[model samples]
Target: MTFTSHARVDTDRPARYLKQLCSHFDRKANSTFDEEKGRTDFEFGVCEFLVEQGALVLDLTAGDLDQLDKLEFVVGDHLERFGKKDGLAVNWKRD
Candidate 1:
């Protein structure tokens, strides 16, 4: 099974930062973050774009993606304040 999550990008830096966080999660979870999974799935590539665009910055980690409980709310609040995204997405799948 595969799960998907969404994150609204407000700025470039924050989005790129979040992308990096996602890349780290992909490495940790041993999963591939396909473009279909998200519009931005690259690390340095996305970061470069964000940097060129001048984004504020927001790093969305895998842990903040836990939707089992109130993790979303907790993480959302922090990201909302830290990053330029309105909200975040947490995708998960069962094997």
Candidate 2:
């Protein structure tokens, strides 16, 4: 079965982060993104990003719980690092 999780990260520059993440991941994974939305396909899972008014929405899917956990950590860790200046954090809810 597929596992999924969602995270809404509040940030002033959602578009900037989205673009940065997509660009960075593109080097290693299949990533496609614009200013408003992005998607990255990893070997274990997929992550979809959306830039909202004041937040970045992430929808992640994986083949299993282990993959889902890894996806969360990988995406959240990178995003937090990129937004470290703003004290960004990602709190995900499983679905």
Candidate 3:
């Protein structure tokens, strides 16, 4: 099965949050940050902003599916819904 991920960009501190989230994927998510998009500042800013929002980075990857054997918590719920920008998205509903 092919896996697709939908994430919310912090636009302020992305790297830090990205790292925090990737930890679930073994503390080192397989994804790489692309600098060609001129997102160096935006990346870091988003990461920092996440800290303010009380959101923890999961850092999950497709491979983690095989090793951890843990499900139901890989991807986050707060992903923005595609095909309908109605401003109504499904958040994972933290307990």
Candidate 4:
């Protein structure tokens, strides 16, 4: 199943954050990114990110039903890393 959330981070360099994310997961998983295109994909149900609407739209697939909570943790952790944009809160909620 696929789980997803949109994090509102009004940063001028959203692509930069995406690059950092791709780099963070670099040796551990299969990841690819095209910052110029503002898109990134990661394997093993990690997450796929798209920079849009002043937010980092995220789609994460839980390999199994039991992985839902784990997926939330991963999402929450990463969103935190991206930090708040313009002091705007980063809220993770079901899409």
- Badly placed stretches (over 4 Å) of model 4 are 1-8, 36-44, 82-89
Model 4 CA lDDT for position 72: 56
lDDT for position 15 in model 1: 46
lDDT tens readout by residue for model 3, 1-95? 32222233333444444443334333332333332111111111111112324232222223333322222233333223221243323232211
**RMSD per model, one decimal:** 9.9, 0.5, 11.9, 3.3
In model 2, the runs with Cα more than 4 Å from the true position are none
Clashes of 1: 4
Across residues 14-91, which tens digit of lDDT does each residue of candidate 4 receive? 677777777776656666878633333434356667776556566566566446456656655765656654443455
Off by over 4 Å in 3: 27-73, 77-95
Q: Show the colliding residue pairs in model 4.
A: none
Weakest lDDT window of 10 consecutive positions for candidate 2: 27-36
Instruction: Indicate which candidate wins on lDDT.
Output: 2
RMSD of 1: 9.9
User: What's each prediction's TM-score?
Assistant: 0.29, 0.98, 0.28, 0.66
TM-score of 1: 0.29
Comparing candidate 1 with candidate 3, which one achieves the higher lDDT? 1
Which candidate number would show the highest TM-score if scored against the true structure?
2
